[model samples]
Target: MKKPIYRTKDEELAQIFSSKVLPRLRRLEFFGIIMAAIVLLVVILGVLALTVFRFKVPDIKLRAVTIDNYSNLSGTLTRFNLTLREEIVLKNQNFGEFKYDKSEAILSYGGKTIGEEEISSGCIELTYTKLVVVLIEPKFEGLGSNQNLGGGTNSGILTFNSYIKLSGKVNLMMISIKKRTREMNCTLKISLVRQAIQDYYCH
Candidate 1:
């Protein structure tokens, strides 16, 4: 006859711990590692999204145009000169500063250039609007018999067109990047009787 082997209570308890509790603890540790990895990935994606959005290209727009002053509407239409002072609002909607070079605004009547004004170079801060004023002195010449001028003078109104372009770069995080251009074309009408702008729009 063979006798069965016997174990102590402490040994049985140790065996149960190794077989059951050890495996459960290992599974918990693996799940914790996976959860931590997922959380870290989510955080990295979030930071990338924020960085891309913050440093994206800027949007520049011409918000408004106004005729501040006009002169020399009291003489013969073909022999008179008109000096125009116009105000334009340059709006920058971005998280960076825009630095533009010196540019000029051109005035045209009857498809011919008549006057020009120089715009000084400057910087526009993030999410702000800059007001720029330019003065153009238009000389009436070479269009002695244009029917449009005659009609406009008879109706006490004058129509003109203006164009401006600003080329610049965006400064983000103290570094300049991304060359951009902003342009505006405006058609305006001035009432001779009121010496004021009748209508104006820019594109």
Candidate 2:
């Protein structure tokens, strides 16, 4: 009779694996995966906190404030076709509180106030000029800067000057972490620049 080549229990079995019958994960790989997950979670949370619980200002809000009903304007200009109309857009962009009282807009060219418009908003309009551009072929007695934009250059002479004063209620994050736009009187005086020129040789 042939004896089976069977090993006895006392001889012991090949230790396939230890523990609860499940494949054990390597310590280094497990720790690496855990750390990666933790870092991802932390980054996501940080981004959320900044986006939801702080002062967030928009790029620019072009709200029409002029008496005219138009928002955008475009036209070609010349002697016979020398007329252009435009509506102003005021931009409000800021993280700090707005000082809408001291802000204003003044137009000038060659050291002269050919036209002037005032802006007394209660906040920031840094993205746009307070005095929206007004294009025209004005009757100038001497050869100088008409200092008006939006005329589309019908051939002659033109230049533009502008000053923006942002002042008003500063938008802020409330205690509940909600963004609020509130008006507060502040002083923001943008300087008046008038060193522009335009000479078309319109002999």
RMSD of each: 5.0, 12.9
Cα-based lDDT for every prediction: 0.75, 0.37
Best by lDDT: 1
Best by TM-score: 1
Q: Candidate 1 clashing pairs? A: none
* Cα error of candidate 2 at position 38, Å: 9.8
Q: Model 1, range 121-147, lDDT digits (tens) per residue?
A: 998898777888788877666565433
Q: What would you estimate as the lDDT of candidate 1?
A: 0.75
Count backbone overlaps in model 1: 0
Give me the runs in candidate 1 sitting further than 4 Å from their true place. Answer: 1-78, 142-148
